[model samples]
Target: MSLETIDLSVTIGDKQILNNMTIKLERGEVLILMGPNGSGKTTLAFALLGHPKYQINKGKIILDNNDITDYPTYQRALMGLGLAFQNPVEIPGLRLSMLLNAIQMKKSGSSFDISSIDPKLIIWARNKTRELGLQPSFLEREVNVGFSGGEKKRSEMLQILTMDPKYIILDEPDSGLDVDGIKLIGETIDSLRSAGKGILIITHHAEITKFVSPDKVMIMSKGKIVDEGGIELIKKIEEYGYKDYEGVQ
Candidate 1:
């Protein structure tokens, strides 16, 4: 049972973005991919979710032994693949509450009043908003519209929780969080791991590594994985820097 990419190479326009990258995240484990800017961490996230802009030159995306290499983005999501964006986008004219209701409609074939969301979902959303240090009133705001960085991240989590995909890809989730926010994220991640969701966290910041002890850490350089190991690899990278792993096979 795994969500993985095998021998994947991707290119955008005439420029190659990823080169024969292979990554695997088993159920109930957390894998961290760390790299400096332009190392293709975000590109991997996009490719895994089947973003059309990234052309797959060759590779296979296997989700729970199912070949989803050619699956569309929404199809991949419906098949239990999920992502939390590093920079969440705002959708004008769309209330967060309304979006949750829409997701329920799409996923469960559930229907409800357009004016009122399911009461249970509202309660859950309210609790989640509070747990993420957001006021329940946020459920009423337009998605990511007028939200602070921390708030947008929390909003993304709320949606992810509602969807509850089995495999989660979080793109720099701790990028702009304070201590409390980071701790809350750590707790959320721990819960997800316990619930048996395979998670891949992409980040260059080591602060997030302090909160959760990952099963494996991968160092990506110039679109390829250069080094991979346990937590010790993180410490080494911290001391000697990513320069040590550059051009390393």
Candidate 2:
């Protein structure tokens, strides 16, 4: 019933990235993984998704009771696990709607082909884009190409909505967003929670807490969890920063 990592250590190239990282993301809950830069927050996110380069030195990745530590990235995604990159890449020829249609087809187990947009698919994409404050025309543009920072984030969110994974990993979703953009993202998170989706939001700033207070907060340092508690931990980090939090468990 949870996506859990046990004694999960990861390495990239010759250097160790995560140190026995144990964590849980339960259904219908938000778990905040906060840390400073190079604290291995993103590493843990990628490791959980079974990224190829992030070799799992030891430990297990269990999702809904299935051991996925050895599963490939595509298999992990098929098992209802999804990760949103901190920096989304651009696709020059493919349209955003095309990508969304492809995800929808795969998610629903339909035959995959994108010769033309289905009318229903276009309607759905248009509605989602409008909800994100994007013009309908944005859906026709090439994926992430020539998009503003906020637009790109919204585009990523739209893809997530189409995919509709059971669990979501958002890596610094609010990083470059303005006030309005952050609020939009907060609303989207609220919707996801209401839909009973488990979320792991990896972020350095506590600003996101104002809109969506996490059920639990884990402070990560030096690639290991240093502290864990309720919302109070976020407040403490906001007040004093990670300087006093290392090795304080």
Model 1 poorest 10 in a row by lDDT: 109-118
Q: Candidate 2's error at 249, in angstroms? A: 8.7
Weakest lDDT window of 10 consecutive positions for candidate 2: 240-249
Clashes of 2: 0
Instruction: List pairs with backbone clashes in candidate 1.
Output: none
Q: Write the per-residue lDDT of candidate 2 for residues 1-249, one digit (tens) a residue.
A: 899999999999989988898899999999998888899988998998888999999999999999999999989998999888898999999988889888888887888988856789889889989998899999889999999887888888888888889999999888888888888888798779889999999887777888888989998988889989988988888899988966654
lDDT of each model, Cα atoms only? Answer: 0.88, 0.89
Q: Which lDDT tens digits does candidate 1 get at residues 115-215?
A: 76789989888998899899999988999999999888888888989889999999988878888888888789878999999999887667777777799
For all candidates, the clash counts are 0, 0
Model 2's alpha-carbon lDDT is 0.89
Q: At residue 6, what lDDT does model 1 achieve?
A: 96
TM-score of each: 0.96, 0.96
